[model samples]
Target: MFVSKRTFSTYRALFHENPLGLPRHKPAPTIPRAHRGLPKKMPIAGVKNVVVVASGKGGVGKSTTAVNIALAAAGLKRRVGILDADIFGPSVPKLMNLKGEPELTEKGDRLIPLTNYGVKCMSMGFLVDQDAPVVWRGLMVMKALQQLLHQVDWGQLDLLVIDMPPGTGDVQLTISQQIVVDGAVIISTPQDIALIDAVKGVNMFKKVNVPILGMVQNMSLFICPNCQHESHIFGHDGAARMAEEFNVPLLGQVPLHADICTLSDSGKPIVISQPDSPFSNYYRSITQNMLNRLQEIK
Candidate 1:
């Protein structure tokens, strides 16, 4: 007697049709699933407007811009808060020089955001160990994000600046799908590689119906600390050209400066550290342009 081996796919094929060329009924076609409409957007309780600072790629000064812009708005006497939505790589904690777990509200329901330099802030960095890696899957990440968004008590804020993780990924999608995002500010360096990703970032917001507030050209130029000479180390006019092509405003260009980096690492962003410095003025200008765009959209 002869024996034969058959795999799962072969077994499936045998049941679906006759191998001996005998007539058999065809298998039913799969009906396409209906598309679920967009999720209902819920507004954060005390936030008047939600602005997310995003970038197509990482290392383009997005987190720095988010912190400084929020600080700049606060400097203008508007209540502002910064939410580090970058679950895997939270930067606000180090940038804001804040640590320790958040305390519960009086009702013992929500976590109170940490405050420093007159701006409220919340980040995953505050909850976990500084060196521990977030080696979890997507589902686990989403759950963590939900708690951060809804369980933080920010009191009253004129603006809630969300520092989103770089690229168009799960966290970005969840935030856009779940919340009423007032607008998005895209950040990019004046380099072709970075600008390519920045374009995608702008398009992603447009597809989700989030207004494109403007783009910030970070590291547009590097100024020598010793000598007052400007260098376009990352290429010149890349983001400016892209902005015109996309028809979005060019908020401002921030030069690559040593003080900006050192101050941010020390939890003293340039806006507050050197308010009179030209670098500080760059951030303030960007903040003003962002506010104007928000008003126009409204």
Candidate 2:
């Protein structure tokens, strides 16, 4: 099934390199906003690259992957910041247990991002009530995203990870069309429904002329707890085949581990809390690959 899909994509590539041809629901919908405000366009100096972690649909562990990958970058002893661009469902604060609003530096109204696990973090949750509905219009969301990138002073070094809202929506398009994304990492499980959307996501970036770092197969496998046997919970290698079809790098395959769920909910990522764990090691390797790619991209 996977191979056939790729073959079609390859054939279609001639018509146009539409990485994301079309979403399952015909045309993708843009969120409604009363006003269309121009996003404040400003790049943080010394921040080498901006990498966005996105997916065709939600609930594919995109946020979790973004948080862990950012944590992994910090483990490499580099300054990092995560922008919780998922305004409607901000999870960076909870995933990393980053509490409190960013403090203001003495630099005359300059707001400083909060630090955790040696990484600077910022999120909408910290700014307002976590559980309260965002009640934001599209234009407002864009304005907020822009403020995060410009208003805050993300000091020096390494990369910035933007945990984008799911799907190819107005906000995502606004960012991709405006912000100079260094690259994008699309996350998906091994299911047709998920992959279909994942393809849409990959193609969305492609349409915007953004570099696709690769496809991340989250929940590629599930190891039984009692017997230690691996099971193809979602199926196998769909992402790998997709990567081959698109000629993008297949960075790594992360399994469904019990520890990842438990530790992450406790604000302890497997990478930081259990560095020796297999899952943690896998993330480290993926992060290294991402870093090497970033260097090559530069």
Candidate 3:
């Protein structure tokens, strides 16, 4: 194409204005030096100690263990509450058989946690419909997590168990950086696959300076109900070895039992449904170990 003299002159003028035909570079924004410090960890009001139950991946009975642990703690005559931190898949409502949105406190500044079976509970599941999905980005999730962490009236509990979402991601880091967690209970099946992820979770807590209370091995054994035979379903002592390797205590092992699943699904955890049952006893033992670990941390 041929350009007219006027058009060629215009192009020349544009080139002179910006030889590269690109906008001039501007300095990147900087944060104030004083504001660059890491955020201070805040303690949850009315909560004496906070313990997070976490896993490396999903499908590891982490929530089940958490619920039973809270119930067991309550059974031991200590005030206990559980917070379901899995905003995307909150299971505390179903596990605790709680429903409806939480009521705001008299000051209208905090949410009142729901109570059941002598244990208080809170979760995003209670705030939204059970069947609905939490389709939110990272910012929204972090905001909701902040609300759950600090804006709840727990009413002076001895222990607050947080059910962390699976994986090492934004929510995990945010929780670690925001609150002063007393300890963490890493849950996993007795499988290399699961233990690998559990290792990551352990490292994450360590990096954040949260004390690792110990590890719990779920589905460690499957007793044949009919034959009275014991079987190592996933593998034997996987978590125990992991605990030894990591130099953390091996809290306890929870056998794989159909009743545990059925009872939990029915909104009646084993500890509450069958308090004297062996499964309940396992959870009670784990809770005791956790309490001991927390005491040591203190």
Candidate with best lDDT = 1
lDDT ranking, best first: 1, 3, 2
Q: How far does residue 171 in candidate 1 sit from its true spot (Å)?
A: 0.5
lDDT of 1 by residue, 122-241 (tens): 988876679978776776677667667776779999999999999898889889977889999999999999999999999999999999999999999999999979999999989999
lDDT (0 to 1) per candidate: 0.84, 0.76, 0.84
TM-score of each: 0.88, 0.84, 0.87
Residue range 1-298, candidate 3, lDDT tens digits: 2221121123224333432111223211122245686667888888999999999889999999999999999999999999999999999999999987676654444667889999999888876667878787776676667767777779999999999999999889878888889999999998999999999999999999999999999999997767758999798899999999999999999998888999999999999999999989999999999999899889
Flag clash pairs in model 2: 19-203, 20-203
Q: Which stretches of candidate 2 lie over 4 Å from their true place?
A: 1-42
Sequence-dependent TM-score of model 3: 0.87
Can you tell me which runs of candidate 1 are displaced by over 4 Å?
1-36
RMSD of each: 14.6, 13.9, 14.8
Q: Write the per-residue lDDT of candidate 2 for residues 1-298, one digit (tens) a residue.
A: 1221222122223322221121122222233443875443335666788999998889888988988899898889877888888778888898888876555544323346778888888887776656678675656666556555555668885889999888898768777765668999989898778999999998889987789988889999998878889998888888888989999888898999788888888988888899888998888888888788777877
Supply candidate 2's per-residue lDDT for 215: 81
- So what's the TM-score on candidate 1? 0.88
Error of model 3, residue 149, in angstroms: 0.8
